[model samples]
Target: MTAPLLEVNDLKMHFPIKSGLFSRAKTFNRAVDGVSLSIQPGETVGLVGESGCGKSTLGRCIARLYQPTEGRVYFKGNDLVHLSHKALLPYRQNIQMIFQDPMESLNARHTVGEILEEPFIIHGIGDAQSRRRSVAKLLDTVGLPSRSATRYPFEFSGGQRQRIGIARAIALNPELIICDEPVSALDVSIQSQILNLLMDLQQEYNLAYLFIAHDLAVVKHISDRVLIMYLGQIVESAASETIYQSPLHPYTQSLISAIPIPDPHRKTNRILLQGDVPSPIAPPSGCRFHTRCPVAEPRCSETAPSLLEAETQHDARCLLINSQ
Candidate 1:
């Protein structure tokens, strides 16, 4: 098992909702509640769900951007939650994040070279000349030109900006990169290029990735395991191919069915899910998907299901499968 590279157990993050002039806490948005996951070294795990399902929040917690209200996040045998800001420095360098919007992530005033070199500077690596030399090679590694070092972010297209972001993330040579919707904003043609670039970088570095995206097809192409999140809870997790071929969770089945087959001749019984995702501030009791699940049993509304392996390594948090 290689003792999993990262282990997140019963992780929870709650944002308080305050009311009145005094701002007394009224309620809390349990953005992520009792979620658990693990990522082995050199493996890519994809987190997929509709918008506002807490995938990004989970990613941030794993990155230690937000303090978890509950549970533990262990990376390479170190507990991230207990680390003081100063003590967390080394872990920060080992885990990097690639944001969704490159334009927003990259500073407009900083040249490409400066942006990429900031990490090395923060971590205090390399001299000025060596840093400059590494900058050009990094640009080349991400398929950007060395001349790009001198240009502002606005001068490049969206794809190029993402490439620059990639260059910056890898500048420190981290082992894990949390990609938050990396290609959603790019045009289709450009998206493939970015995906391929990520693939190449992973192969070259033997890096692990926690790819968070709403796109199922994209996850299918890149991930070894796929996790389906809904209302801040994971409904299913399994080998990507297993989930695509025989999804155990009702929500997962619907999601996989929604993926469009390239061949028009092949038929797919698309399951268009009904009802909006329940609010995280007050998620539904028991099984969250009972309101929309076609095969939901009466007991589903009264008991929450824990994710457990049903066959080999396939896991699903659904009462139906638990009974079977």
Candidate 2:
């Protein structure tokens, strides 16, 4: 196999949980706690979990948009975690992020052309005339008319704004792009179009993707590898087909079972998870999923299970499954 384009090792991002009459130190929300993975060049790795599972936080950390409290982010063998803001600029062009909400991500005041041109100016891609030429090409590449470039973000519809967001991401021709629910906001019909656009772009640019989403169906469609995260930790990492066909961890099983089947006659085993995800501020001592895992044993609440490989490259954090 080829060397990974992006490797995240024990990546952690903790937001301080402060609470007091005058605001004193309390605890921390362990958003991404000891998470690790890698993304090969031109491959798509999907990060799937519930809303507060720190999927988006991890994406931002990978893109260097948020500084991780602990752990290392290596892009093409370069350690990004230790790099200062000034030093991180070179990697910014190769790693871009598409936010979940197109409206919030794009500045309402800036025109489409201005938004796309910002990266060129920041990275010093070209002077006035050349940058202008790049802007027009980007607008057309995203399937938007060049005339739309002069219009503000508010004037465009949701899908159109998302297209603009995608154009900006590719303006630098990034080697890796972290997509934080890129198509979740749009209607179902528009979702497929955006997904197709992303697949096409990946093939055209040989780009890698760290796709963060809660929707398993969408992830299964785009991801070559899938990581199942829970309570800020990855419980399962395997090929997309393996994870969907034979999930190992209880959390993974439940998540897989939750995916709706298109066929009316197809009856599947539903592993419904009980209880809500534990508070990250005070995560369970050993296995964070023990609180809700139906197959959880006493050892689950006492000793944590490390992610161990099964057949080939598949891995999961579960004692019962691994022992089998």
Candidate 3:
């Protein structure tokens, strides 16, 4: 059997928050506490969670955009966590990122052609003429017209700009792409088009994806597996079908139940939590989800639950569920 293209082990990213004029005291916002997962070649792993749940931070860490606070990010047997910038250059070509806001990510000054060609230029892939040709192909690949390449980002609509971002990300033919809410900012109609484009590109290039999004329905459609995160930690990880069908974690169950049903005639039970997600800087004492978990037991508040396999190959971080 082939090995995974990416392996994240006990990964954490903590941003220090300074206080006071002298900044004598400092606190760390534990954006990502301990996230561990593996992604095989050409597989899509959907990361779903609420806002500020560290999904984007985790994606950035995997992309090596942010140096990890602790743990290892192994890609093809090498730990990327401590690799120097120069040392990591070669691996950069094998991994890429598509940020949530295309308007912010894309260079407003540069033409679409220039933007797409930047990756090849950075890696010194092909000469000027060849790079231009590659840029044209990338435009075509992302469903943008060749003429659009000469236009600046501001000239395009939100969806069009996102397509441009997608075009640029695949320009280097990276083995893995970290897509952080790539379609969330676009219209619902446009979101489908973008998702379809990504799937088509994945099939064409044999690409692997770390798809981060808040929309469970979208994740369900595109992902082979799903990872549910809360309070800077993964609460559950399982196959997409299994995660939706038999969610053991109360947090995961609540999230699934919240996905709107299309049929008005059908009745469904929605699991509503009591309060907001606790601040990651000072999270709950025991299970991070215990404060909001509807099915949380008395033991949940006193004892932290490690991520344990509740069923075959399916893991959840819940004492109540794991005990049963």
Candidate 4:
């Protein structure tokens, strides 16, 4: 059998905190405690969670934007966790990321053409004329007119700027693109446009996506598999249909119940979660979701439930279900 395109094992990203000058104390914020997943060629894995659930951090770690604190990230059968900066360059081209805000990610001073061509220039892929031609083609490929390349990011609408970001991400022909809330910054109408564009681009290029977003509806529309996150840990993961239809984790159930249905006439229930997400600096002792989990039991507060596949192909980190 062929190996997965990308595999992550026990990944963690922690940020240190400094206390008083004389005190000898080490404190760290667990942005990503322990995350492990894999993506195959042309697969779309949707990561869905509430704000500040470490979804973006996990994506960044996969793209190597931030070096992981611990664990291994293997891409194309090579471990990337310990690769030197120089050695990692080739892999950088293989994996790219699309940020949540296009305006913030794209340089305002650089023209759209320059922004798209920068990848080719960095990798030394083509000459000046060829790079310019490639930039124009990228614009056209992303549904923008060739002339739009001459404009700056601030000049375009939110959706258009995101398209530019998408164009740049695919310019390198990356095998995997970590989309970090790429559509959350746009308007409702424009969000669909960007999502559709991304889908079309994936079909054309056979690109794999680590699609991160807060909107379950959007994830349902695009993802083959969906992962539910809470407080920097994966609470549940399964095929998109299975996750929506039969969520075992309370967190997953709450999240799925919250997706707004368009039909006002159709009656539906909403699971309103109690309390805000706990601080990542001092997460709960056992299952992180136990603090807010509606159906949490006594064992939920003492022993952390491992991510186990109780049902066929469905993994949940909840004590209520049988472990793998």
Model 2 scores a C-alpha lDDT of 0.91
Task: Note the residue pairs that clash in candidate 1.
Answer: none
Superposed by TM-score, candidate 4 places the C-alpha of residue 22 at a distance from the truth, in angstroms, of 8.8
- Backbone clashes for every candidate come to 0, 0, 0, 0
- The total number of steric clashes, by the backbone 3 Å criterion, in model 2 comes to 0
lDDT of each: 0.92, 0.91, 0.93, 0.90
Q: Compared with the true structure, what per-residue lDDT tens digits does model 4 show for residues 157-190?
A: 9999999999999999999999999999899999
Candidate 2 vs candidate 3: which has greater TM-score? 3
lDDT tens string, model 3, 247-304?
9888999988887899999788988889898999999888998888777778888999
**In model 3, which range of ten residues has the least summed lDDT?**
17-26
| Models sorted by lDDT, best on top | 3, 1, 2, 4
* Per-residue C-alpha lDDT of model 1 across residues 90-143, encoded as one tens digit per residue: 889989999999999999999888998898898899999999999999999999
